[model samples]
Target: MRYLRFTNWLTEIDRMSGPISAIWFEEVRRHAGTDAAHVYGGLMATLTAWAELRGVPCEGVPVGTIKRHATGKGNAPKHAMIEAARARGFDPVDDNEADAIALLLWAIETKGGLA
Candidate 1:
């Protein structure tokens, strides 16, 4: 899928903000050899590159935004999201991936992708 590479790039994307405004884990910085600021910055850079290649606009909401929208709590557990996914009629084998997709669906709904 077109998003496969994008997802990989996201992992390597440098953080653009420090821990203060950063919503992701600090280990993302440590493993990426950059601060949260640089990682987020790199993420934007990668998005720009991908958009140029695809000739389409692609904007991503913050993970926290997705999480809060999906479960009513920003720090909801993976299993909770998986349960939500099941309720929505999608069977996800992996809880974390399920949660992420659930968050994606939540964002889509908020953006009027759903009726």
Candidate 2:
């Protein structure tokens, strides 16, 4: 199977969200500079750089904020977040997708509108 590059995805998003608005990026847990943390942190940095190039404001949202907004608890389990998406009538493909969905809702609700 072929996978899309992160830059490609970001380009698509930049195209869709024209005029460049604020980007609400969710901050994941960084455990003393683990690999996961490094990769995610790098991705976020790249994303922020791209947003900067386009003059888009990027804001980092805490993971706990996403969980609390989506599941009513900051420490909700993965399954609970999935259930929360289901409860909201979303059929998220996986936990990551569910997280994206939750963050999307939070961004829309809290940040007025998307770019």
Candidate 3:
């Protein structure tokens, strides 16, 4: 159901603009004991597979890379990351939303797209 909604959302975007040239995600792993990490990892895997099946160009950036891009430190703490987003004039709701915005900016810059 989530995938369906996401695909539908993508379709809507395509209708509004054009085909999305690519998709980007921050690569993450559960490592050992975190439940949210495991769930998000699984969801990302599913989304990646679906995107591949649909022939959408899907790419992932490591968490460290995103951190470095945003804050000059690959091991930035969540509070630091939030601060970095604020520095960019974004009033993020939380670290996760701030990270997503940063990731989106990274994708645009990396893909040579207008931001």
Candidate 4:
């Protein structure tokens, strides 16, 4: 359902602009149960469907990985991610959304593509 909403949003965004490089799923696990494998698989499917629909690129990365890469520690605190976000050249007001976007960009850079 969330994935579907995201795809819809992406499609709407695409309609306004041109195809983009990727999509970001922030704290995606929070939206799932204890089933990690199922969550990841569902993520892949959602991304694939979104990519196919928009003819754009897409990828998914865990929120913690983003915090780790952005903040240094895999289990860094939120304040740490906030500090790191500022240090990384983003304004403080942009922390949450920017962190999410950064996480998505990191995933896209890491993965080849949605396919």
Candidate 5:
């Protein structure tokens, strides 16, 4: 049921966004609990499979890499990431939003603004 909901959400986003050039996600190396780890793995597998079915490029960025790219610190805290996004002219409402913004920026910069 959860996987279905997640795929439905992805479909909704794809419909709204038009053609997806690529997909990027944060690659978490560790989880505090086994259940969380399992959930992450399941979601990741679902996401990759979905992307593959659609022929879209899907990649994972490391947590430390995102933090360093956003705030010049590999282990930057949530508040620092938020500040970094704000500095980049984004008003993120939460850490997740901020992280997304940071990842977008990273992708754009790394891919020479064509991504």
Candidate 6:
């Protein structure tokens, strides 16, 4: 049920955003608990499979890389990431949104928007 909901959400996002040029996700290496790790693995697998089936380029940006890019530190805290996103003119509602914004910026700068 969770996977179904996630895939449905992904489909809605893709529909609203038009043809996806690429897909980028944070590569989380560590988790506080086994359950979290398992969930992350499942989500990652689902996302990669979805992207593969659609022929959309997919890449996982390391957590440290995103933190460093956003806060000049490899292990920046959630608040620091949020500040960084705000500094980029984004009003992220939470750490996850802030990280997403940072990831988008990094992808655009590094891949030239995957052009």
* Most lDDT-accurate candidate: 5
Better model by lDDT, 4 or 5?
A: 5
Over all chains combined, what TM-score does candidate 5 have?
0.92
Q: Candidate order by lDDT, highest to lowest? A: 5, 6, 2, 3, 4, 1
After TM-score superposition, the amount by which residue 115's alpha carbon in candidate 6 deviates from its true location, in angstroms, is 11
For candidate 6, list the clashing residue pairs, or say none. none
Q: Model 5, range 38-79, lDDT digits (tens) per residue? A: 999999999999899999999999999889989999999999
RMSD of candidate 6 to the true fold? 2.0
- How do the residues 66-93 of candidate 1 rate in per-residue lDDT, one tens digit apiece? 5566677766687877777787788899
Compare candidates 2 and 3 on TM-score and give the better one.
2
**Top TM-score prediction, candidate number:** 5
lDDT of 3 by residue, 5-109 (tens): 766776788678866667788877435558676667666777777677778877778899889888999999999989999999999999999899889878867
Instruction: Tell me the TM-score of model 1.
Output: 0.53
**Which run of 10 residues does model 4 get worst, by summed lDDT?**
106-115
Q: Clash pairs of candidate 2?
A: none
lDDT of 5 at 39: 94
Per-residue error at 11 for model 3, in Å? 5.7
Cα lDDT tens digits for candidate 6, 1-115: 7777887888889999867888888898889999999898889888888889999888888999888889999999999999999998999999999999999888887783344
Please report, as a residue range, the 10-residue window in candidate 2 with the lowest summed lDDT. 1-10
The parts of candidate 5 lying over 4 Å away from their true place are: 112-115
In order of TM-score, best first, we have 5, 6, 2, 3, 4, 1
lDDT pick, better of 1 and 4: 4
lDDT of 2 by residue, 50-92 (tens): 8888887888878898999899999899999899999999999
lDDT tens per residue, model 4, 1-115: 8677766776777788855765556546554456776766776787788687766644556667777667667777767777776776776664676576567556656663333
